[model samples]
Target: MSETVVSVRDVNIYQGSNLVLQDVNFNINRGEFVYLVGKTGTGKSSLLKTLYGELPLREGTANVAGFDLKGMNWKKVPFLRRNLGVVFQDFQLLTDRNVHQNLRFVLKATGWTDEKLIEEKINDVLDKVGLKSKGFKMPFEMSGGEQQRVDIARALLNSPKLILADEPTGNLDPETSDEIMQLLFQICKDYGTAIVMATHDFIVINRYPSRMLKTERNRVLDSAVPA
Candidate 1:
């Protein structure tokens, strides 16, 4: 069995007087692909924020990447993010920087020095996302899919244990979305990197079946598997 990478116990989150989620209990095992689906305002983003330590847990308990979400330290936010690979619908890449420079920036900021070693690691991760030739291209020069691949490459620089994606394919065409989905799945299968993606794309969910978790009627529904 894969290791349980994320564990939540009756987690509740709120924004002002609004209770976004109630009693959200679930487990995400290593190498598992999970889909978080719901209406536009059903706490998807909030959950991702909590996982990455952007928001504090107001009630219950949560653990992600071995850090306590309820009592997470301020200084450890960077450390938590380093263990998590985060992707967004909008490809967040520096337009002025080449793919190599972008990846290098993350390495240098994350405390990776040693020019020779940094270059080697950058090359290795670029290759991992099937973008070895893209190292010299600018973000705008690359195709949308390729740009997202570069984003994935940046996320993988730290060899994160889990990938938390927020609407990862929300801006892509159907074909491009399929390609991105396949890429994410392949990475999880090959590297045992568990993934929890929040998206409204039910078409992709229908095309590629995964363990589904949805927020409905003030509760989290794990409906993909028979209980």
Candidate 2:
């Protein structure tokens, strides 16, 4: 049986009073790698925001990582986020901290308190992202790919069931992009972590095709559906 990590149905996404997307319905299952592709300004960000609890799902029924999105408030957003991980295009690692400290910060913020467990968790994520030895290195001291890996490591700190990645390969070179893609696929396959990545890189898409959700003309199109 496939486990569903993200379920959106009859959802209306908005930015303030402006409606961005309507009647959006989709479900991402465990270990599935899905692509979110659409031109800019087509509510891609809004949909992603709604999933991660950054935007409120005001007029629909949706659930993410077992949390109901309808009527979700600010106080409940953090709890929703802990079950999810988000990856950004730009490596959003903290400038002031080393790789270890950055991951440690997220764990602490998310309510991890045991010092021994914290150290083990940090090591586990770093090892998963292939940054075990670079924990002492500052973000500035690493290459773009390495920094992005640290960003990924940070995302894995909570062992999230779903990861929402926004243009994760946008800033990398072709080779680096390939490496990131491979790593992402490996993680999904190995850990049953569902990934919904938003990207405009068609070349990457052609090289590694998967189910896609396209945003166009105020609606989301699912590739899995027959025309």
Candidate 3:
């Protein structure tokens, strides 16, 4: 049996009065890499938002990395996000800062204050993401693949147990997407970080098949079981 890290039961989400997700339920386990797929606007992003408390779970319950989303307050949102490493379709790296500086920015904002230790940690995570020599390069100076690697490195600075990525490879070409997926999968295997990535690329799914969840007909479907 897998260790459950995220559990969503009968969850419903609303955005300014429109019901986006209805009765969504799933259990993602530790060290797992799961894919979230559906047509655009099927509520994949909303479900991820609800799990991370970006949107409120008004009709049910979701517990992610030990925090209950249904009852959590704004003060706890940062705490919830701290346990998660979130990646986006766009590389949200700062153009002004070099790769190492960008990662150090996250560490400092998250309350890491040690000078020597923070530098060491930044180098460590950059090395882990296979971007050791590029730490001094700015985001625009690197290739798209390298920039995405920096995004992953920034997400790893806090040692999160779970990563929620929404359309993380939407902008990349196939080869670059494959490299990024490999890096994410390696993170799961090496650090036991459970990942829930929402994507629309079918070829990637066929290549690295895992447990999947899809949003369809306003319901979340568990792809491992017969529908």
Candidate 4:
């Protein structure tokens, strides 16, 4: 049986005291790559925030990477996040650090103490993202796409079970966007890691279609089933 990485049911998502989405329901399984699409204020980001424990799940139940989201305190947020990866539209690489240092920071923050294992894991993820030889290069030394690869490599530091990517391809050119899309899909297939990517790029969506969860009219519509 396929293991579920994210399970949300009858979820009422809120930003502060205001409700953004009602009766949201979905299940993202291992190796599944699902798209979260919607207009700017259609609660796409809010939903992702809820899943990542940034925003509280006020009225529904959710399990992300085996961590219960309901009543999740700030103390437990880091633990939950450790099992999940989050990719942003901007590369968000530290300007002061090289690619290797960027990834090293994350490992140390996540409690990795062995130097040998850290080097091995960083090299492994860099290789996975096609940046095996660029680790010593600074963020500004590389192209936008290459920096983005480092960001992805950082996400892979812990071998997360799920990745929540917010507009990962948003800042790239068409070709670069395609490359990132391919890399993300490859990661999903190769590692059995589930991905829930939020994107507004219909062109990219059309180029590589998958199960879609759209937020519209204050609700989430699962296109994997009949409307």
Which candidate number has the best lDDT?
4
Instruction: Select the stronger candidate by TM-score from 1 and 4.
Output: 4
For model 2, give the 10-residue run with minimal summed lDDT.
Answer: 148-157
Off by over 4 Å in 1: 224-227
The TM-score measured for candidate 2 stands at 0.98
lDDT of 2 by residue, 16-49 (tens): 9998899998888999999999999999999999
Q: Candidate 3, overall lDDT?
A: 0.88
In Å, residue 142's CA in model 2 sits off its true spot by 0.2
Leading candidate by TM-score: 4
Per-residue CA lDDT of model 1 for 1-227, tens digit only, reads 76889999988988777888898899999999999998877788888888998887889998898888888878988988889989978889988889999999999988897999999999998998889887999898888888888888888999998999888888888998999899999999999999999989989999998998997777788975466
Compared with the true structure, the alpha-carbon lDDT of candidate 2 equals: 0.92
TM-score of each: 0.95, 0.98, 0.96, 0.99
Runs in model 3 deviating more than 4 A are: none
- Model 3 lDDT tens row, 1-227: 87789998888888879988787878888999999999998888888888888887788888899999888989999988888898878889888988888888888888889899999999898899898888888898998888888888888888888998888788889999999999999999999999999998898999889999988888888986687
Give the deviation of candidate 2 from the true structure as CA RMSD. Answer: 0.8
lDDT of every predicted structure (CA atoms): 0.89, 0.92, 0.88, 0.93
Q: Which candidate order results from sorting by lDDT in descending order? A: 4, 2, 1, 3
